[model samples]
Target: MWGPSFSLRDRDRMLEGEWHTIRLASSKKEKVEEEGSMRVFMEHMKALEDKSIGFKFHTIANEECVDHYVVADETETGEYSVEYDGHNKFTLFDADPGAYAIFDLTNFKDGKSFNLVALYAREPDVSQEIKNKFEELREKHGIPKENMVDLTQAVGLIPERVLVPTLQIPVATLEKEETPDPPVLSGDFSPGLQHHPFLSTHHPATSSHI
Candidate 1:
């Protein structure tokens, strides 16, 4: 019931292609957010083969969108060392491989560590069955419900973001997949871009040089 539990499910190419952020929760925030938009692209590098994953986060700020790249290398079954906003440890769990996935990430900045959980789906959203299991997993991890935001439900449910230093706001946009283009900041994920409070929430990585 303590420590981190990394799911050992076999998921070859499960993370490949595009994903939308359906839910995002941070212990430091109130309520799970359900009315924000952020898309992710995962590419499997066969040349790196079990070495790394091509990861990026597309976020909308103002009326414009920007892509931030992350350097990710597989260190364990469901664990990765990443670079974005400094260094981070990303862990995967409760993955459906084809439907959805929930992951925990701890990002180290300056001299502090920040942790949050996120739910990503292949479609605009996932089935209730997938969401139900994610809910269970969430409680199991002791993640406060108030600290998360669910984006798959009512847009009217959008809550004003809590005031926090260094936190950026996400625009109210529905999930949409687009063609992958070169990132505006590959391995250079400065908060200058649309930095989601939760990694609702996937940030970038820089295991090596940025």
Candidate 2:
């Protein structure tokens, strides 16, 4: 089974909480219906960022929308856990044994330094420079590009806003009610695989803005 290996620098950059916006630039689709569904999925992500909303990626096994899981124990090689959440949701890796890439993007926003993460299943249809980087990693791992998916163009990042509430909601009141779970993918989702449920079209809407 092929898995993505990230350098220490790359891992640190991803764990850093400097990114604000994310976009879906591309995905893997085998049919016209899948393509349509992917478009809707991209639109939903855009809507979430526009509204400054956040989501959690549930990694528990057998749960719906469990697209990825974290290897709780690290190996002697110092490989961190393979997990995804609102913070590292864009960080891509194969939930199963497959080829993947863990890379970094350094950009300046408003004169402040920030980083973006791009995870690819296969080589992306990007510039020669970017392709070269992916190629180097592929060669190092001896993984063929044919087995990977080009998700580079399918996703992107934008600015994000941090909100700090002045007043805290009472814990007693909050605990009195149960919050509904995020929607799960119905038609195309695999039974045992982890999924990004926040990308579902059935996500709730809000009038709030960042």
Candidate 3:
């Protein structure tokens, strides 16, 4: 819901129609209670082996989907849940204790703010050992334990430009032609004559001798 992924200054690619499995952790009493209560319910869902994940793409131009998801609550029965707002947030329940697999759906309206919403994957019967390992990896990577959202799917939209062989021009052809320098100004020229300035009167040739 909030993290480095949301703060990225770049546009991320949209990945929809992709499924994943994840591990999630929570320390809140209510969340812990829910985890215990919902454990059995989660296992009932179809088993999803593919851990590959992805993000749902969105923009200001298309906001209807986010609006609907925010207001609407679909019963996923531990499979998934959607949180509503200016953007949509979804959570899946697939992970060992203290961990949950996350599926993020982002609506890039601000290109700032919390533009991304995350949902968790649903998987029951996660062992404590697995959960510990998940936490270990997260800590090793300096990942935040709170408000965590994984962006395994939000890759760069534009591919890197490729370097291809090109036709070469001869060195002589590539050389630029020399440009002539401008003529320098000198005091030999009369400023008034060059500018054709207005003259009030031409005094009669003053004869110094006369």
Candidate 4:
């Protein structure tokens, strides 16, 4: 059985038990003109100015589900527990409504490769390349362009140092064991958020494992 959110078709390309590093290329935002204008605008924005993100996937329960982790940087980390339907797409429940990330695996002359592009429900700036790719995927999925947001503003510059967190799973016991609980985001799991325009807050403790 597959998870309600993910598809099985992407399993072959998105190998489990492996880690992939994603380097930011560019960032921009989309603007829509008047209803009849049919004109769209893209504005570039900066966040995570110099950071490298990390992703890791692990199949659980005979491939019925997956436990994934997103390491925003050395200080912040978020865990995603999702079901696998296919096509390397997994629904994220924790994001702000209508926001999710797609793990796209591309094959190049060098070999197979993978990258993640996030779709936000709100309006945010992103790069042209990312916007175009996002539009194509949105159309393929039959999602309305107006309902989607480009939240990849932090995906362009590479940081000097990158840190990938290790996964932590509960050990099995001989007796009947209770199901493991879903992973939770640490207090400092805010990605691409450095200085807030409204309120100032203190950074939280760093916890690597879920």
Candidates' RMSD to native: 13.8, 19.9, 27.9, 20.9
TM-score of 2: 0.28
Please list the C-alpha lDDT of all candidates, in the order they appear.
0.55, 0.30, 0.29, 0.29
Candidate 1 lDDT over residue span 1-210, tens digit each = 112464322343546766667777665452233223322222221213555665655543332334555556766456777666567777776676566777777767789765567777777778888777667666766777776666665222112342232245443432354557985666756663256534333333323423
Q: How much is 88 displaced in model 4, in angstroms?
A: 9.1
Deviation in Å, model 3, residue 45 alpha carbon: 19
Q: What overall lDDT, based on C-alpha atoms, would model 2 receive against the true structure?
A: 0.30
Ranking by TM-score: 1, 2, 4, 3
The all-Cα superposition gives candidate 4 an RMSD in Å to the true structure of: 20.9
- For model 2 the local lDDT of residue 113 reads 33
Per-residue accuracy of model 4 over 131-203 as CA lDDT, tens digit each? 5645565455454545443323432122112111112233565246766798975686564535443232232
For model 3 the local lDDT of residue 65 reads: 11
Q: Tens-digit lDDT track for model 3 on 68-184?
A: 111223332322223322233333312222334333332222343232222233333244664554555445445457633232332112112211112234677557756579899
Error of 3 at 64 (Å): 27
lDDT of 2 by residue, 1-210 (tens): 223443332233223221211122221222112222112111111112121223222211211112211222223444322222211122222211122334432333344432333343322233455455555544454444443344334322220111113134579998999999989756866644136332322222322111
User: For each candidate, what TM-score against the reference?
Assistant: 0.57, 0.28, 0.21, 0.23
TM-score of 3: 0.21
